[model samples]
Target chain A: MTATVSYVPAPDAAPRSRMLGAQTRMELRLLLRNGEQVGLTLVVPLLLEVFLNLPLLSSLGGSRRIDFVVPSVLALAVMSSAFTGLAIGTGFERKYGVLKRLGATALPRSVLLLGKTLAVLLLEVLQVGLVCTLGLALGWHPHGNPIWTALLIVLGTLAFGGLGLLIAGTLRAEVTLAAANLIWLVLLFAGGIAIALDSYPAPFADVARYLPSAALSDGLHHVLQNGGGLPLGAALTLLVWSAVALPAATRWFSWE
Target chain B: MPPQATHAILAPSRPDEAASGPALEISGLIKSYAGRRVVDGLTLTLARGEIVALLGPNGAGKTTTIEISEGFRRPDAGTVRVLGLDPLRDAAALKPQIGVMLQDGVGAYTGAKARELLDLFAAYAAHPHDTAELLELVGLSDVAGTQVKRLSGGQRQRLSLALALVGRPALVFLDEPTAGMDPQARRGTWGLISQLRADGVSVVLTTHLLDEAEQLADTIVVINHGRVVATGSPAELVRAGAEGQIRFRAPAGLRLTSLSDALHAGASASEEAPGRYLITGERSPQLLASVAAWCAAQGVFAEDLAVERRTLEDVFLEMTGAELSA
Candidate 1:
C-alpha cells in the first residue's frame, strides 16, 4: 500500500491490444518476482558460463574457450527463460484455474497468447543483455554482426517458446513439471549446450545441427566468434522450427 | 417468525421497474459428458439488479450451469443469453459487462501482489472502478502488496470479490461467494452484495448456506438431478408445502386419546422430549384455536408455545429430498 495507490477509473473503450499490453506487463512482473524462476533463468546461465570458461575447472579448453562458452550460455539463457520457465509456469496456471478464469475475461485467447509471447520476448532481451555483459566482462570479444546476433536471439526465443507452449498447453501440471525439467536437462547436455557438436562423432554432430538448441548455439557461436555478417543456415533452421512449433502449439493448446 | 413477514423486510423502494429484459436467460440447457447428462434441460432467468441464488446438493450441476452461462463450457442443446447477447458467440462483447468470482484460485498470478493483480484486471475492462476504492470496498486495502499465494483463505475470498467488482460489471456470477469466509467476513460480503444490487448489478450465486440464500436472494433456484426442481422467492417457497407445526413444553404422561379426539382427524401429535410436544398439521387460524382449546381442556399450562411455519428449508428438502450440502 502506498500514497500513490490511487487508480484511474477504467474506461470502457480500451482496445484488445491495450489489454494485452497490460497483461504482458503483469506477466513480466510476475516472472521477475519469483525468486526461484530468476535463479533458474538468469543466474544459472551466468554461473554456467563462468565455470565452463575456467581452464582449471572446465572440461572445455584453450584458445576457443571464451568464444565457445559465451554463445552457448546465451542459447542456454533463451532455453531457461522461454522454454523451461514458460512451460512450468503455464502448466501450473492451467492446473490452478488461472487460464480458465482468463478465458472468461474480455481478453481473447489470441490476446493471451500474444501477451505471453510478449512477456517472453521482453525477458529474453534481459537474458541476452546479462549474458552479453558477463561474456564481455570475462574478456570474450564478440565477432558477429550485432544485427544478426539480435535477429538470431529473437528467432531462437520464438522457436523454443513455441515448444514450451506445446508442452504447457497439452500436459497435466505434474507431468509437465517433471517433463519440462527433464527436457531442459536433456537439451543442456545432449542438444549441444554444455558441449560442442564438433567433439561428437560425425553422425551425432549432423543430428545435433538440426536441433533448435544446437542451431541457436551453433549460429551464435559462428557469428559472435568470427564477426560473420549473416547466419543463414542457423537462421533458417530456427525459422523452420518456429513455423512448425508455433502452428502446432496453437492447434494443440487448451486453455483449461 | 412466519415466512410471510420476509416479503415486507426491505420494502423494495423502487417499484420493481421491469428491466429492459432479463439479464440472463437460459432455456432447456442440456450438457452431457461421455453420454451422461450433467446439466439436463435446466432453465432459469435472472432479472437485472436481482440476486438469485442457486441451491443444490453436491454434483447437482450448479457449476455446470454457471460455466455454460459464462461461456467457459458449451451446452449440447438450448441457448443462453447474457445481457441479451449469446454468451458464447458474443462473449468478447459481453465479457466487459460481466464479472465472475471463481470458486477457486481467485484467478490470480500467485507471485503477483494483491494490488498489482487488481490493477492488472482493471486495465482489461473497458471501464473499471478505481483500484484503491475497489480494494477498500472488499477490505483488502491493508494487504495490497501481499502476494496472492500468501493471503489467507478469507483474504483470498475477499480479493476474488474485489476482482469481480473492479470492472463495475452490469452482471456478476459468484460461485459460493462466501464459502470460506468467517462469520464477520461473511456478513461484510453480504453487505457488499446488497450494495451491488442497489447499484443495478445482477448477481447469480451458488451456495450451500440455506440462510445465505434466504437472506440475500430475491429468488432461489433449486436444482436436483441436473434439473430445476423449484424456483420461487423465499416466502413463496416456504408456503409451497403449507404444512405448519405447533410446539409446546408441558408435563409428561398426558393421555393422548382425548387430545387426538379433540383435534382435526388427520392431525398427529407426539411428545419428542420429556415435557415437549409437537403437533403437525395444516396451520390455519382454526388449527391454532383447536390446539388452544385442547390445551385448556387438558387443564395444562402449555409453556413456550411456538408455531413453526413451513420454511424454504422444508421446501428445498421436500423438493430435492436431500440436504443442501449433500
Candidate 2:
C-alpha cells in the first residue's frame, strides 16, 4: 500500500462559501432529478402550448385562439412550476420532516430558500424557451421589440413565482393544493384569457384587466399578436404585486 | 462503545468560546399552543460529555422543551443556551455547534439518495463530517444510492441520525430516536449512540423506553404533566422508588397473619394474595435469610419465590403514577 502525499493548510482559513456551494450543488442536482417537478414544469406546459395552438383551435377562431392561448398558457406554466409545484413539494417536505432537519443545521435559511427559488426559476426559463419555440414554429410572428418581450417575461415570472410562494408557504399542503388548482382554473377561464375583459359589460372588465395574472396575459398578448410595445404600467403593476406578495409569503412560509 | 473517541471527532476543530460552560442551560422555558401551556417554568442544565435521557409519557412537554433548546420555537418567556449561546437569539452562531434530529417531520424526501441528504446537511455546518464516512457510520453505506422515501423505518431513522451528525455537533438532540425498531435495530442504534459518546458528543435523548434510558443515559430526567417529576441517575431513581421487593407463595395451611408477623420481624411484609406475600427491605441478605428460616421452621416450602431489584420502570411508575407503557 502506498500513502498519497497530502497538502495541509493552516487551520481556520477555509471560507464558508466553499462548503455552502458544495451543498447547494447537490441540492440543485436532486431537484433536477425529480420526475414530477420535471413533468409538471417542463413537459406539461410544452404539451398544453402545442395542443391548444393546433389547427383545430386555429381553424375555429382564425388564430385568435392561438393568440389568446399562448399568453394564458404561459400563465399556467408559471402557476404549475412556482405555486403548485412548490406548494405540493413543500407540503411533502413538511410531512417528511425535511424542513425541520434542514433548520437544525447551520445553513442559513436564506440559502435554503434561494436554492429552491433558483431551481424553480431554471425550470421556468426552460418553460419560456419551449413555449417561445412552439409559438415561432406555428407561424405566429411576434413583432415586438425582443428586449421589451424579455422584460415582460421576467416581470411575469417574478409576479407568479411570488404568488406561488405565498400560497405554498402560508397555506397547509391540502389547502394549498386546492387553492392553487382553483386559482389556475379561475385564471384560465375568467382571468381575461379566451375572452377579453374589454368584450365584457363594463366595470368587471375594467377591474379584471388590472389583475396580475390578467395583466401578464394582456402584456404578453399585446406584444405577440399586435406588435405592441411593452405596457410599462401593467408590467409595473405586476411587479408591485409581486414585491408585496413575495416578501409576505416568504416571511410566513412554514416548514411543517 | 464508550463516548470519548467519537466526541473527539465531533468536537470543534477550532477553539470554542464556551468550552467550560454547561453543554445546555435552559431556564424558565415556557411555550403555549393556542391558550394551553405546554411547557411551563422548566429549568435544567446538562453538563459536557454526558448523556441525559428525557423520559415522559405523550404530551408531557418533552417536545416543547427539546424544540426550544434546538432554537426551532421561541419561548414565550424563557432563556435557553446551547453551548452558551442563546438558542433563539444567536441561533445562527449556535446551530453549527449542535446536531438536532427532529422526529423526521420536515419534508426533504423526494427520490434523492441518502448520500445526497447527508451532503446537503454537511453543507450547513462549518466542518461537516465526510459524507461517505457518515453514511457508513449510520449503517447506510450499502444503500447510499437508495432514495430517502424508499428507506425502511429503521433505515430512515439511521439516515436522520446521519444528517444530524453531518456537522459534527458538540451536542446532539434526538427525539424519540428509537420509537419503532426491532431488537437488532434498537441494539444497532444503541451501539451508534455508544459510539457517539466515545467521540465526546453530549447527547440529549427523549424516549418512552425505560430500558433505553437505563442502558444509555448517564442521568435521567422524568417529566409528567409538563413538570420534572424526578431527576437523577437511573439506578438512583429506581433504588429510591422501591428497594427490591420480594414475593413468594407460602404454605397453604399457614396463617397469612402469622407469616406476615414473622416476615415483618425482618422486613416489611404484607399478604398480597390468598397465600402469597410480598416483603421489602433495605438489605437483600437479611430479608431473604429470615424468610428462608421461617419457611423451614414451619416445615413448609415457599413456591414461586422471586426477588426483584428496582428498575427504571418502577421509578417512572412511582414518579408519574402511570405505567410507562400506559
For candidate 1, write residues A158-253 as lDDT tens digits: 999999999999999989889989988998988987887777789998988899999998888778876777788999999999999999999999
* Candidate 2 per-residue C-alpha lDDT over A1-256 given as tens digits, one digit per residue, 9 for 90 to 100: 0111111111111245754575456655655688877777778777877777765643324255566666767766776776677666766666556677667777677777666676666766778788878877765565677677667767777777778777767777788778877886787667765456666678888888878777877887777666788787779888898898888877887866
* DockQ result, candidate 1: 0.39
Instruction: Considering only chain B, report the TM-score of each candidate against the true chain B.
Output: 0.86, 0.90
Off by over 4 Å in 1: A1-13, A56-62, B1-19, B249-261, B264-277, B282-285, B299-304
Best by DockQ: 1
DockQ of each candidate relative to the true complex: 0.39, 0.34
Question: Which segments of model 2 are wrong by more than 4 Å?
Answer: A1-36, A55-72, A193-199, A226-229, B1-17, B104-107, B252-266
What interface Cα RMSD is found for model 1? 9.6
lDDT of each: 0.83, 0.72
Q: Residue B125 in candidate 2 has what lDDT?
A: 53
Over B1-326, each residue of candidate 2 has an lDDT whose tens digit, in order, gives 12233333433443474567888888887888997888877878888778898898888899889998998888898788888888878877777777777764214655678887777666665445668876776578999998887888788887878776766677899998876666787888887786767656789999888889989998888988777888888778876746768889874456656656766454677777678877787656767887888888888788999988867787787789886662
Fnat scores for every prediction = 0.42, 0.33
